[model samples]
Target chain A: MRATLMYGAGDVRVETVPDPVLRAPTDAIVRTMRACVCGSDLHPYRSMHPSATGRPVGHELVAVVEEVGPEVRTVRVGDLVVVPFAYADNTCAFCREGLQTSCPHGGFYGNHEVGGLQAELARIPFADGSLAVVPDVDPASASDALLHSLLALSDVYLTGYHAAHVGAVGPRTTVAVVGDGAVGLSAVLASRRMGAERIILMGRHTDRTDLGRRWGATDVVAERGGEGVERVLELTGGEGAHVVLEAVGHMPAYEQSFGIVRPGGVISRVGVPQYESAPVGFGSLFGKNARLAGGPAPVRAYQDGAIADVLAGAIDPGLVFDTVLSLDDAAEAYRLMDSRASLKVSLRP
Target chain B: MRATLMYGAGDVRVETVPDPVLRAPTDAIVRTMRACVCGSDLHPYRSMHPSATGRPVGHELVAVVEEVGPEVRTVRVGDLVVVPFAYADNTCAFCREGLQTSCPHGGFYGNHEVGGLQAELARIPFADGSLAVVPDVDPASASDALLHSLLALSDVYLTGYHAAHVGAVGPRTTVAVVGDGAVGLSAVLASRRMGAERIILMGRHTDRTDLGRRWGATDVVAERGGEGVERVLELTGGEGAHVVLEAVGHMPAYEQSFGIVRPGGVISRVGVPQYESAPVGFGSLFGKNARLAGGPAPVRAYQDGAIADVLAGAIDPGLVFDTVLSLDDAAEAYRLMDSRASLKVSLRP
Candidate 1:
């Protein structure tokens, strides 16, 4: 079986690797149908994160169960499923509270027994709790776009929904989404679906902003930092947005969020913050009572509803996949995503 | 008129000062009936905050209206009122949302036109918005405990309620109040009032913890730091409290809170954080999905209900006043509170 590996910064390759086998009674072996390069994968690709040399590299996937152990009850052979990035037993107190990412026994793929989804065959633990089976439908009858969009429910789309949900975006809320990546655009789609009256996308990319408008952004602010804050404040009658979705995890993006959230508003941050400590002084959130909430998304908690909406065509988050490649071009897929040349790229196994 | 002045870090003095006079139509001259040395006042007394030399220093007070300008319509002469530490217009968006501390036209008493409350008279701005009139009750007819409790309602009691309210403590929740100060005890009271079934008070002082128990703490953890975390975890069966109220603003207090909160729980901090930045990395709040919310207490927003509760004799928060002094001994009151010889001290002008 072929798998993608990152040997070092700027070095990615597709190598023939031994196939995964069931190791536990609850395990299932999944044959990868579709895998994608995630924005987070760029962290290690850029030499910013610890180098996991020669390790399996991808997390997002739409796969089919090829084999299931005796205890795997919910999903079985021949079922197409969306794999959430994290594996959880789905029954812990944290999981019951919809915080699966923090489940007592949960761990992310590529970090635990499951190698990675970018491989042709991968092991899945706690199969019933980790896999969301797609409804029985003929793949030959579905459009490529529809299938790709369903694949997004595996991670990014649900992550975006977590941003909107935690930010408390809904009717009577004016939302400001920071960042124009796939997740940010998905957040725009999510805010709209959540009944937000006005959505503002903060991005400098004309191409992405165009798609953002189509997805549901009522306005776009191309400025950054202080100027960007002014533009957002101007758009919302000088009070700033009631709900701010921080999809960029850098200092600047976090600073802009603090500046643009109205007093008593919430800033839900889904972006994996790269900084070790954020200087939230009395001047920032304290005086204004701005609440900050969000983390590694509980995708499993949101998977069912999000997939239903995507299948119903309420949103086509797959539009974020501006490029696609074959398994052999996995290296090139990494290059395209790392260089920001593609919003997102999918690989067909 | 006489006022208490902080001329240096360890120097406090009672000196004759010009009587307060209404400078605007919105102003009301208040004759101070009761004033107290606040826990926050100790911040400057200990030189943790910048010392304001030759400046009046108290912020909590219960006063009787001595005179009112033409624009002061709600409060009239001889009306007893609780003066919230921060003065607000009570009509701005922030104020309307019950975030009066963030009100655009509001400012802390000492920082604004009102010099300070530890004086014979104070010139209050936004009288109609900042003054919560105590229901008709003669000082001669009412017990000193009753009036003292109303004074507590001005700052500490309302501040405690803010902590519990922001922490989202209610029925079926296990609450932990961190701090043995007046505000922390008030939080215990507030949490019980909010219907919290199990309340844990984390403090080492037997005297304060005794009072804490009387205020409604179901259990007390007389430990600090790692040991404190261990005790709290043990108390909650290793899952931690559902709601943690952080009334102490230091780093250790904040760190203890993170250690004792269960995954997916909320930590509401009302303490004025003294540190410039908090290390809320992936290792801390993000991974656990623990939410952090709170800031300066919006005392005015919680004043009415809190005062009503105290006046009804259902609870007596004034018990926190372990010592009292006459107007001439205002400096001694500060010394007692700063030395920890008294939990709280009241001054009668």
Candidate 2:
């Protein structure tokens, strides 16, 4: 099977790898039908995260089950499914509480023991809990746009939804999105779905800004730091935004998100932190009575609602995908995504 | 009028000060019947926070209204009241949103422009919002225990309640109260009122720990930092606490509160930061999917219920008072409070 692997920073290659097979009683192997480059992947590709030596690169995928372990009762061979980025037992107390991302028995599919999905075939663990069936949609009939939604359900879209939900975004709420990447763009859409009265996207790129605007950004602040926060405050009549989505995992973005939110507001973060530690302004947060909530999105928890919304055409979350390529060109997709030329790049396997 | 003033760190004196009069349209002059030293007061007394050359020393008080400005409608002269630490309009958008502490016109009584309650009289701005009527209770019949309730309502009790409420403490939830000061002890009581099944009080002082147990604390972790968090985690069967109340305003206490909360849980912080800034672990908070909330308590928002609870014996928040001194001994009370000899020191005028 052909899979994408990263040798080092800016080093991505498509090479033949051994096909994955069910290794655990709850595991299942799937023939990858779709995959995509994720913003998180760019973290290691840019050397911001520690590089993994010769490791598979993607975690988002829509695939057809090729094999299943005896314990996997819900999924069977040839069924089209969407796999979440994290594999959970779904029976744990945390998972039952809809915090599957923090499930005690859960692990990141790509970074931990299980191999990732930027390949012709991939193995999924805890199959009953991690895999979502695509009721009537055939793997071959799924459009590139629809497939992008599947990839999004694995992490980005659900993450954006989680950001909005955790921040308590709703009607009459003013939301500020802090990043211009795919997840941030998705947040703009999610905030709209959550009924935000005003949506502000803070970013610098024209293309990303346009995408954000299309996805329900009522305003955009191209400036960074104090100036950007000031603009958001001014737009919110000096009260700052009611909610802020910190989708860029960095000090500047995090600080900006905090600054632009009003006292007693919330900042929901979905950006994967590049460092082990970052100093948050506790004094500022304490004084403002603000809240900060985030983590890996509980994609498994939000899968049903997000899929329903996607299927209903109530939102076009797939608009985030700026390019689509063959799995053989997965290396190019990674490069384009890394270079920031594309918001999201989908791949067909 | 006699008042307690801090000339500098380690310097407190009882001296004659000018009597307060209505200073704003919403202001009211209150003749204090009772006042108390607060944990926050020690911040400036110990030089942890910069001390003004000559600043009045108290914000917690039970008083009789001496005068009211033309705009003061809810309170009038001759009424007994509990003055909340914060003065707010109660009609602003923030206040209407139940965030009186962040009201646009709100100001902390002691730190801002208004004279503080250690004085015989205080000019409380936004009187209608700051003063809660004592209702059927008479000042002559109010015991020292009830004085604790009054003083607690002025700041710590309501602050603790706000912390627990914002942290989403509820039935069956496990809570950890950090900083076993009056506020932390008050939080233990508040958590119980909110129906938290397991309450862990983190304190090093035996007296405070005992008081905490009396106030419904089910467990006590005397250690700080990693050990304290570890004990809390152990008590919760390794799942960590569902709600954490950070009542001590310092980096270490803040970190301890952050470390012990479970994923998807909340940390409510009512601690007034002593420094202009303090570091927060945003990455850790985001990864754990935890939440942080709180500020100055919206005392007026919960005053009715709290007073009712106190009067009905549903809770005895006043048990935290350890010493009672005449108003003339205010200086010594401040010193005792600063030296940690008393959990709370009540000053009767």
- Cα deviation of B227, candidate 2, in Å: 2.4
TM-score between candidate 1 and the true structure:
0.97
Clashes (N, CA, C under 3 Å) per candidate:
0, 1
Model 1 alpha-carbon miss at residue B263, Å: 1.3
* Alpha-carbon shift of residue B30 in model 1 (angstroms): 0.8
Candidate 2 local Cα displacement, residue B164, angstroms: 0.8
DockQ values of all predictions: 0.77, 0.53
Question: What value of lDDT does candidate 2 attain over all alpha carbons?
Answer: 0.83
**Which digits, one per residue and each the tens of the lDDT, describe model 1 over residues A228-327?**
9999999888888999998878889989999999887888888888886786658888777777788889999998887788778788889999998998
What residue pairs clash in candidate 2, if any at all? A280-B280
lDDT of 2 by residue, A193-279 (tens): 988989999999999899889889999999898888788888989999889999988878877977888988888888986655443
Which has the greatest TM-score? 1
